[model samples]
Target: MVRELLLAHGNGGEETWTIIKDLFLKYLDDPILSKLEDAAVVPLEGHIAVTTDAFTVSPIFFRGGDIGKLAVCGTVNDLAAMGARPMYMTVSFILEEGMSLEDLETVVRSMGDTARSLGVRVVAGDTKVVPKGTADGVFIVSTGIGRVVYPGLSSHNVRDGDIIIVTGTIGDHGACILAAREGLDFETHLESDCAPLWDMVEALLKEGVEIHAMRDPTRGGLSAVLHEWARASGVSFVVDEQSVPVREEVRGLCEFLGLEPYHLACEGRMVLAVAEESAERVLEILRQHPLGTNAAVIGRAQKGKPQVLLRTAYGTHRFLEPPMGELLPRIC
Candidate 1:
């Protein structure tokens, strides 16, 4: 076995076959993928949701998760937000030559474990290697396919009186990535909230929660989801600033960095708009899940021009601006 990766590993020769058989297949064995064909065929019914995402986080490894986990969860969450049950995925890797084989194995193993726990199949993949300086340590791209279980979940579905609910504390992912990259030391450590959320959505569906629109706040945090929804639906969201949940550490880090936590990213948490009548019951169902212990009703959609209004604790409301330009690099 090689201690480090070499360009030859991607040459589709002996080294390439050895790496595939020994590492990827060893961890991510799937009946459909075992056929080793150019494309995978699987059975599916009803509406299907498919999404693709690429993970190039600055630090390959972080406090809570690595790139592998991010790639899988990010893709799966995209499908889940569409009210889908994730079924299959394909992974492709771009590796820099001289990368550690052990790190590669660890990443591959994590991808397998996360997919297995989520009942998603890793159906197909490709590997390519670049010169040491030509690419980051590693980058993984995953495409997910899921069966739509709860239909009509869309950004355009948010109603004027719809209630906005956040699944948990926000900004952990962006803060965690920022700190990890900057080497910031804090008394209380922060970790990325990277996680797969199919179970949480499934739970809400099982309980008959009326979900009009759903989004997993990622690259641009809750603000992005709300702004996009507002733009799509031509509605405004009145968010109570005090009601937004943020970890003490995350808040502190954002304060020190002069950053808006609302504009930061969250990987594990979700933002949804539901019927006013079902708001409390939806919160109850969400709170029942381990991933939603910090769930809260942050705001409500209102009839207005497309925008987001932030009601500060001081009792003044201001238009929350969308994050402009590149806020951070390689965060998710």
Candidate 2:
């Protein structure tokens, strides 16, 4: 078998079969996927949530994760934010010619490990190759299908007095990626906070916490999630700047770069709008979990114009703007 990917590997001939059997199937082998059919067949009932995403991070590997892990977590987290239990996935790859098979295997292995940990099955997949320099080393596109475990969680569901909760410190993933790409020399290393959130979110639902809205701040980060909810719910938001969690490393890097930490992305954290009555209990539950140890009530939803008001710790106020354009392109 060729150690470097070639265009013929995607020709749907013997070379393709060799990779499918020896590489992709070797790691992601499941009954459905092993069938090697054009499409996947699985039984899905009840309210199902489906999401698809394409990842093209500049570097395929980074601190705490690689493109493969990002692909799985990104898709799984989308379903989780909707209060769903992720179940099945379809992954496709766009491989650039001359890419190393070893690197490709590393990505596939990461994807398999992540999916297996979450009880998700990769039921279908496809691969295509392009000439070198025409594309990144590898770009992954994934689709996830999940069962809606809890119904009616939406940005529009936030009501007045709903307490906003963050699952963890924000912007770790974004900062980590930025530092890695910039080759910044720092005493403390930054790592991506990229992980699946279904377990934590499921814990909240199981504990009877009433959640109105949940969003994983991705491209535009926590700031984006809050501003979007404010508009969708037709209610203003008041966030205490001090209460919102930000790691020192992340804040330092943002300040050094003249960027706002809140505008950076977080791959694993969740922002929740919960009922005021359940605020403290939610905090108690979140605090007990490993991922939610830093969870805090950043603000509350109120009846006002749709906007996010930032209440500085020094008794000052300002509007937190949503992200514009690409702050850091491909900082996934």
Candidate 3:
């Protein structure tokens, strides 16, 4: 019963919250969330950016990371994607009754370590236990609060002629999750690319690069994110297939599986739009970070049909559409 009223762990909006009008709490009203503050004004200072995210990847644990680290990093990354310096997070856990305490402790410790590494604190949290069949092994809901430092930043600010750059390889997280879940044999191992991006964003800002837009490609992958920006900014985009970074292993796996790399998920990757002149500086700044070592200029904004056009390696172009449904679902 409780699970039905909670937000599901991924970006699909699978779980929906309840609305008990008769027993409505004063805090759940529009007046509260509309305040637009990071947290309730119990005792905080200044303005902050706040975001909530839940995690429920199938199998719970993956090759490079588990649900614990992914939950914390997912929220923190959202805040960073908004150009905010993350500070605090509130974690809530939904555990199945028969789950082991030892495993729970390990997940908690992983969450603690991930939060600490980002210089953030877990100020508050909640836990609820449900019957075995009522829930997945476990689910985590994280609400992140970050202080906004960069001003006038958003994907809505993107413009035509802006250069689009991506940090590192795409489809790693999705491919890794799928590879492990299916127990597929491959020549190389794929790991989840999950991490915080605050440091890289800060360093890029120092380079005086004009960032028109930025986003972490998670559930819907680069294809969804690009289509989103194209619609929001009212501009067309051209992506060179050969320019976008994809590991040979991931490429081979996707090819064998009849999957599209651009439509695959990427947890630790970001796409940014910057002025043509500022693109080089942004690339240089990104290259300095271990996370951005494989960063490359993959596309450019153009004035056309407000759609995504992919330039194939053989001098052919085609429209890139959003995945019909979950190609690789719950791969956050």
Candidate 4:
């Protein structure tokens, strides 16, 4: 029986199979994964959306979710942003020596639970054990494949007169991690907004919403997404500063820490560009879902020089620049 992960488990020998067959397979069981083949064969139809992501969050476990859950949600959301339906996923893990088997099992179990709930399968995986201190406790890389149901979605598809809507409040995930890492105390508790978003995206498609562009505000947050859309579509954005939704606790933390909430990452939020006429209807649909109850229309796009302009509560306009430098390293 495996008690702890060892280098021999990654040496391409009997121990490796024992751990994979006994532990990983036991948790992530599926016809594709059960084949024990070098590569998984999956069926696909229509255009496919493929995305890969690596997770290196310092504190493996955090409020609302852990590294395992983050790895799955991050990849799933990437495909969701493309208006795709998630189907299959491949996971790889790097484990440090002396890592507890119980902890590894917990992580694997979390991945399995998330995959099942999202109606996706973990069809293939690999594991490696590195010498102690040579690697962090763990790192996960996931690759996802999705079937594109709604086609023609592009960042360049955004046009003048399109309204911008965010699925929920921004900066929740980033602030949650920061507070957890620093042991900061506040009257209100902050939790990461880590979650799978394909269902919410599917709802929009079902309603026949005309989606011009969509992106999950991840590493660079709201500022990054707006700047990217502005540059890609060659249009300017007039954002209402007061209209952008920010949780009271998140706003407080950002103010106390001298951080801009718009620059902080969100794991479960989507920034959308749709026709102005459909903006309110889209927001109405989003609010029906638990994940998007706080959705808001924050801005409108117009034909002008490619840049984002923020109209502040004080009635002043200023350019909203893309975030530069590493705001929070290993924040994904």
Candidate 2 off by > 4 Å:
185-187
Minimal lDDT window, size 10, model 3: 16-25
The TM-score, computed over Cα atoms with residue i paired to residue i, of candidate 3 is 0.86
What alpha-carbon RMSD in Å does predicted model 2 have with respect to the real structure? 1.1
**Model 2 per-residue lDDT tens digits across residues 216-305:** 999999999988998899999999999989999999999989998889999999999999999999899888889899999999999999
Q: Please report how far candidate 2 places residue 218 from its true position, in Å.
A: 0.8
Please report, as a residue range, the 10-residue window in candidate 2 with the lowest summed lDDT: 180-189
Pairs in clash, predicted candidate 4: none
The order of the candidates by TM-score, greatest first, is 1, 2, 4, 3
The number of clashing residue pairs in each candidate reads 0, 0, 2, 0
The alpha-carbon deviation from the true structure for residue 222 of candidate 4, after best TM-score superposition, in angstroms, is 0.9
Q: 2 or 3, which is superior by TM-score? A: 2
For model 1, name the residue pairs that clash.
Answer: none
Q: Which candidate do you rate higher for TM-score, 1 or 4?
A: 1
TM-scores of all predicted structures: 0.98, 0.98, 0.86, 0.96
Better structure of 1 and 3 per TM-score: 1
Q: What is the C-alpha lDDT of each candidate?
A: 0.93, 0.92, 0.78, 0.90
